[model samples]
Target chain A: MEISSKLLEKAVAEMSQLPGIGKRTALRLVLHLLRQPVSQTDSLAQALQELRTRIRHCRECHNISDSDLCEICNSSRRDRSLVCVVEDIRDVMAIENTGHFRGLYHVLGGKISPMEGVGPQDLTIASLVEKVRGGEVRELIFALSATMEGDTTNFYIYRQLEGLPVTLSTIARGVPVGDELEYADEVTLGRSILQRIPFEGSLNR
Target chain B: MEISSKLLEKAVAEMSQLPGIGKRTALRLVLHLLRQPVSQTDSLAQALQELRTRIRHCRECHNISDSDLCEICNSSRRDRSLVCVVEDIRDVMAIENTGHFRGLYHVLGGKISPMEGVGPQDLTIASLVEKVRGGEVRELIFALSATMEGDTTNFYIYRQLEGLPVTLSTIARGVPVGDELEYADEVTLGRSILQRIPFEGSLNR
Candidate 1:
């Protein structure tokens, strides 16, 4: 609150500007840094500075990278023909950690949130459509979040590729793998039943 | 978890090394920074670097400062004969926020904790003894935490100042203001009862 040092106050103010960090937590963190070796703060500052200055986005999918093309887009082992669309790089990382999909990703940067003034133009929708029109992607999978904004973005993109030759698909919506049916939301449970897959087909996944 | 970019991974690693931050929270913060303007990140990094590089400690009290003497030590209004000894600058800030103390502070940097390999030699105990020996401070107030380590540090300092011509006292322990009696811990309640002061003294405070 009443910090004695101007330098400490400035550092705390800057740190509290970050999302989810409050003034007290920021003070605790700044105090912790003060107790640590100067090299720790030097490395932390260097990492953050480099992240902002040198970070790049893949020209194809718009995922964060250090070079023009991201690692996923440049990999030959991934299925370039199958593109899974996501809201941001966090989603890409989440999907990649599952190890279930071999397809490459197309990061849209964010969903179509009209309330937040983020429209289709604010995202990478146009570039994604261009990628599909290049004829290399045989299937474009909609893997966005299951929110209204996610659905709107998917529909908007689907309309843009209406007459295209590429096949369109979306990830299955159902109760999660380890979740109890009773605990699942009504909409998800109903959708799971309505779009139930064949017993033999489910065995493979 | 499975971050694709090396720079992103490095930044997340450094950010998560802070107290109470985890990998997921670190990723969330890093992504939030990526979404913000580059100037925001630049300022945050610059502030942290400057705090580590340019901050100074007061020669008299050891509180963090921008010059040789801290604001408290430089102030002529503060009582020169009374000193409140604390564990660190955080305590100094906390006490200053209360706006009740008008005495100078002596920061010990840390309390004595033998289990953590911290001893009297690791703290500013020698400097504190020297201050008392200088004969300007007529009273020494112990304002350290009410923990075993804090008490040990206080007792150690009391022994060091046994023959000095100075009055020594510790802060009162009691049910905090606005706290319910039923909720007060036994140790504090017992101490409050044992060290009961005059009823008129309570009315004045």
Candidate 2:
């Protein structure tokens, strides 16, 4: 049934386009918004609009920020010698929430999933190699997933930096197969990061 | 615990401020947004911002609209002489969604409540009275509520239109107590509207 007016219908339709929100849920949300004070709804609208205009991906770390550089990358208090590489910005956030890591981050945008047509060349691996070659960093932490694609991506990066003097290690294999790093609890993720193993040699292996 | 980075924390804080969303729920929503593609997230942000700037409450009917008057009020097909007086704009939407109501609406903003310090003077009761007295209306359907405050507000409006030649009526009282008119299903709500009762003259009885 048409449970909403035309304008409300349009608003709900737009909302339904968002991930995970279906038409009924969208209708409920729109109805809830209609009950709210105009100013309250206005704030939500303002925040969403400003989110894109104000926030950008940090060019250095690829983290979300309101400027070219993210707060983590710009902060001097962080450990410049240590860099944790991740598959997405959400991973950066999950790691940051632990507060034990004091290093910078490098978001790869995604893993090398050959089935999805994602290859090493499509990722930020080249930039990572450049960052390591820049001379200040002493350690490179691979905090990617334990999935097949993640393993493949990890091996590819390991091969690229096999001869570098920098200490190269992965966050660890304790993270379950097919599980994302962002979904691992802080205790598990932290333990995995702390117990990282050195890369055993070549991507061909 | 600092469960998210400062930027993510800030975004979560803002999200939790929305009605019915708590910290955990807000975090989930933020994480979901973080997982989306930059373009999709950007669209959500843009939609939110435009929701406020592009939309405004109709000056006449108080329904949300992109222009001065709501589409319903602007439509030449709707009956201008029949005004459906409602407790809020959501009620207007509820009726409009049925595709049945062909009349304009008058949003009272809220029901009269003494304990909550809300009274007739605090609402749009004066404007409603003025609208009825303008002599262009034939019926004033009070789709208020079945609660004490709703009854009181309806009574107040009925008294205001004491001498007006318009047919004064209260939306059917079968609606459950302390429930919002917006939650009633279209069939029940539509039936309630069709079965509206005349507000018989009685001061205290």
Candidate 3:
């Protein structure tokens, strides 16, 4: 009954530290990995090892990149004047997947959250201000989560760029696609109510 | 949009191979790893690499172990004469968690399935027969899945040990605790019917 083995215990402990994984789940994941072919596990190991060593933050906008500048920042085909500001590199990828937005991106690394002891100085706000000060940017879209902390961070950024030429805006929040009103959470319902729009063609009809 | 980054793509692709995970989940896991401190990702990579290089199969029962013998096999307190035959190491863990079983185990790796081309020769059944014939074992318990393939494999093994003096039996099957009949699937219902137990007391009384 006792897991006396050092290697197995160590692997389980490591897996338990991952998000949403417990000790039992960690054991299952470790044992599953142990059963798979050695080559498949080796590939995962190599990928994880290279994730930190090979990847770097884009020098201009702090997006994840293997080179000095990220692919989005380096592309001349993108709308250089319009930049979408996000909380992390993952948001950058999500925006990139929507082929409609042909604009540049600025990754803020994280949002300002006083409860978590995170402040504007701890993030890439200075770099963003510097980018805005350069006078090439037109519109700055804030595509952050609709949490209170996210809003606080967005407001802080907006105040920091006061009198700057960039027009700041945020993504609309409402019921998600394929979801009905019955399942929508209270906060989403409230926000959708507050931001309700007038029907356009129906007014004329 | 195309996944322009090779390293990110590689990491996501490798992660997607895990059970119950798809491309989107792989991307989420990769992005989560990317956001973490470099040391955390390094630890995961090191653990994954060590899992392959450090863990080895037990020579006796084919269970995963860091040494020549597994923890269960090496324990002196367990009943060595009562061997519980299982389909994989997962079943061994499940029975061990109950803390009722005080016996040894033999992992058959997989069940006999002619549809997928797996046969008796591909299993550890021959070694099991040899272990029983060695005169140390007294009883051989079949603790396999309740699937048709599992039943077929159990019958095939029973035929192999027909002349042996060892006792053979299976675990009980019926309605699970805290489960409703409405949620029960057809296979479980059929199994419950076939393996029904006699009434301990008259419900009418």
Candidate 4:
């Protein structure tokens, strides 16, 4: 589109660089910003700048944090021995919203996707292994997605801690809690049947 | 969702304030920005800040511009006797993209929507009438949307120029160039049939 102003064009270009935002949507956003108070734009810019410049990652979990240690890792109430491994901060937020897990997290940042040139070394796998080898972590939960990349990352991490004292486990794959069995995918349904737990165990949960 | 850091949470909150962006999407975008180089975020922030702080509106047309007069208003090649009235800068961009209209524009800023507490005075209608009274414009073309608010805004502006010498016209309403007849809406299809142009005129365009 032929934008009249260079400043507006530059703003829209930068906005469209974000994932899922196209040129039209970017223009709409920039126009909306123009209509609002300058302070609103200033606040947005300040927040984004501060987030990138001052944001820190937890030394232990590799999650985004303002300090050396993240809130999850710093909290004494959370079970440090039970570490849930996830792909990124979004997963950490999702699991935290569920309010089911009571353990600390190990954010791998991303999976080992060969197609994307992200190998095991690109992730936080080395630090995770070191955490397990440190002997404090009693259980390492693989909470990655069900994609092939997720499985590959899990197996790679598992191999790295073959003789470690920590017990390895993965999130269950099956029909969702409130979903009907008929709607479940064949692979998930078959796996759920093969890995069926005791009736009492299901009832207890 | 429970974010680990206050800085990260603030950024997500600010990002979510944008139109069409939800909390989850905001978190995803924020995380994506966190993963990229700090300079990328800095550039985005800088562009937005400069756009908001330094952007100016054309004194004659009220369109976004870097200077007091917009490029369109400043250009001598554009028709000085014709003016297309539009709802916002987006419409100006859309018309300019067509490369057909060489007339200047008068941006209303927004339609007169009483439901949203917007009135005739809220727009740039007075300046448009003043432009017509100045006697330079020989024709005024209404290029607003087909919505009720658009019609109302057009009528309000038309009423303001009651005794003016300029000829008043609206953009032709008809079926879109490549639209299927069967899928066209009843109102549009009926209007297209009622306001049918001569076959030769349609064929020529």
Candidate 5:
């Protein structure tokens, strides 16, 4: 749409460059900023600039961090011998929120998606393999999403650490915790039944 | 959501401060920015700051502008004697896109909403009344949205200009051009029937 002010139009254009945000939404958001005090916009701009320019990725896990190492990697409490592989730090946050997993994380940056031109080489898979070769990690758990890309990345990584002493396993594929059995998707239900755990093991959890 | 980096968390918090964006969406958007080149985030921050700090409002109509006067108010082609009163510049953009109205606009910034603690004094109502008293505008068209707050703002303005020589009118309310009559809301359909125009006049348009 044609905007009256060139500066406003530029701001809207920049805002809409983000995924899922349209020109109309960008205009609304920009107008909202205009209505708010200038300090709000200033802080927002400052924060974004600081994040993009000053942010560092953990040298070990590749998760976004304030310093060379992320808190998880720096923490002595977390199990260094157990690694959970994920697509990005978002998955790290999700799994961390669960308060169940005590393992350290291996952020892959993203999955191998041929459609998007992302390859296994684009991720931190090489470092993960090296870590496994270093003999500290006893088990590597694949915690990526249940998408085709996630499966491909898992298989690719599994092949990379082929015949290594370290064990490789994937997170369970099943109907979610709160979902009804009948209402679950066919493949998910089928997988749930096929991967059913022992009765005693389920009760223990 | 628990973010790894302080800078990342700050960025997400700032992004979620925007209207309609939740914490999850904010994290996703912020991560998307991190994946892109630093230049993109830099430009976005620059554009927002420029818009917020340098943008001006038209002295006459209070519409956002690059200079003292907006394009519509500065142009000689638009009818200065005919003014369309709208809630904000978004409405101006919508009407301008239609290319039907040749009149100038008076942006009220926002409507009167008691629920939000917004009153007439919070908007540009005083300037609008003064504009009417200036004796330049011969007709005022109310182009505000069909909402209780819009009606209140319109009525409040109408009262302010009561007994003035200028004429006041509201845009037509009926079934939208492409909408089916059978599916229209009851009040809208009832109003459409009650305000039926001359069949030949409709054909001429």
Candidate 6:
């Protein structure tokens, strides 16, 4: 689109750099900012700047935090021996909100995706392996997605800790709870059948 | 979502204020920004700040610009006596891209929407009426949407220019080009048949 003002064009160009946002959406967003009070735009800019300039990642888990050590790492109630490995802080939040998991987290930042040029070294795999070798964590739970990259990352990490004292486990993969069996994909349905647990185990949860 | 970092939560809160962006999408966008280089976020914040602080509206047309007069209003090639009234700069850009209309534009900024508490006084209708009464404009073409608010805005402006020498006209209502007539809505198809133009007139374009 032919924007009249140079400032407007520059704003749109920068806004479109975000994921899933295009030039048209950027224009619409910029126009919306223009229509609102000046303080709204100022606050948004200020908030993003503050977050980037001051945001810190937990030294142990690699999740975003405001301090040197994340709250979960500093907490005493969470089980430090049971570490749940996830992609990033978003996943950390999701698992935390479920109120089911009582373990600490190890954020890999991202999975190993060859297509995106992200290798094992790009994530926090080295730190996780070091933690396991330190003989503190009893079980390392792989809570990543079901994608190929997720499985590859899990296998890569599992290989890094071969013969270690820690026991490695992965989250169950099968049909989701509350979903109709007919709507479930064939692969998931097949996996659910093959990985069927005892009838008492289903009732205990 | 339960964001761990106060800074992250603040950024998401500010980002979610934009239209159509909820907390989840805001978190996703904010996390994407976090994954990129800090310089990208800095540039986006700077561009938005500059756009909101330095953006100006044209004195004559009311379109967003960097100077007192917009490019279309300042251009000598545009027809001064023939004005096309629109809702905002987006409409102006859409019409300008067609390259068919040579007339100048008068941006109303918004339409009359009672549901939103927006009335005639909120727009640039007064200056538009003054321009028409100045005895320079010979024809006033309204290019607003076909919604009820658009019709009310047009009628509101038309009532203000009662007995004025300028001729008033609205853009034609008809089925869109390349659209199958069978799929056209009943109201639009009925209007298109009722306001059918002569066959020779259609051939001229």
Candidate 1, Cα interface RMSD = 0.8
Tens digit of per-residue lDDT, candidate 2, span A23-103:
766666766765566666665655554553455788888777767888889999999999999998768867987777999
- Write model 6 residue lDDT over B1-205, tens digit each, in one string: 6888999999999999999889999999998999789999999999999999999999999999988898889999999999999999999989888888999999999999999999899999999999999999999999999999999999999999999999999999999988999999999999999999978756536
- Every prediction's TM-score for the first chain? 0.96, 0.81, 0.87, 0.95, 0.94, 0.93
Off by over 4 Å in 2: A1-60, A65-71, A74-76, A133-138, A165-168, A172-205, B1-17, B20-60, B65-69, B74-76, B163-166, B172-205
Give the alpha carbon lDDT tens digit for every residue of A70-131 in model 6. 99999999998999999978899999998889999999989999999999999999999999
How does residue B125 of candidate 6 score in lDDT? 98
Q: Write the per-residue lDDT of candidate 3 for residues B50-92, one digit (tens) a residue.
A: 8778887787787778899998889999998999999987788
After the best TM-score superposition of candidate 1, give how far the Cα of residue B171 lies from its true spot, in angstroms: 0.8
For B1-205, candidate 1 gives per-residue lDDT tens digits of 7888899999999999999999999999998898899999999999998998889999999999988899999999999899999999989988999999999999999999999999999999999999999999999999999999999999999999999999999999998988999999999999999999878745635
lDDT by residue (A1-205, candidate 4, tens digit) is: 9998999999999988888889999998899889889998999999999999998889999888899998888898999899999998889888999999999999998999999999998999999999998999999999999999999999999999998898999998888889999999999999999988877645635
For residues A51-137, could you state the per-residue lDDT of candidate 3 as single tens digits? 767988889888878788888889889998998999987788778777768988888888999999999998999989999999999
Q: Which stretches of candidate 4 lie over 4 Å from their true place?
A: A201-205, B201-204
Q: Per-residue lDDT tens digits of candidate 4, residues B67-127?
A: 9999999999999999999999999999999999998999999999999999998999999
Model 4: DockQ score: 0.89
Interface root mean square deviation per prediction: 0.8, 4.2, 2.3, 0.7, 0.7, 0.7
Error of 6 at B76 (Å): 1.0
Model 5 misplacement above 4 A: A201-205, B201-205
Model 3: per-residue Cα lDDT at residue A20: 62
lDDT of 5 by residue, A127-193 (tens): 9999999999999999989989988998999889999998888888888887788899999999989
Q: Ten-residue segment with the worst summed lDDT in candidate 2 chain A? A: A1-10
Residue pairs clashing in model 3 are none
Candidate 2 TM-score to native: 0.65
Computed on C-alphas against the true complex, the DockQ of each candidate is 0.85, 0.14, 0.48, 0.89, 0.88, 0.89
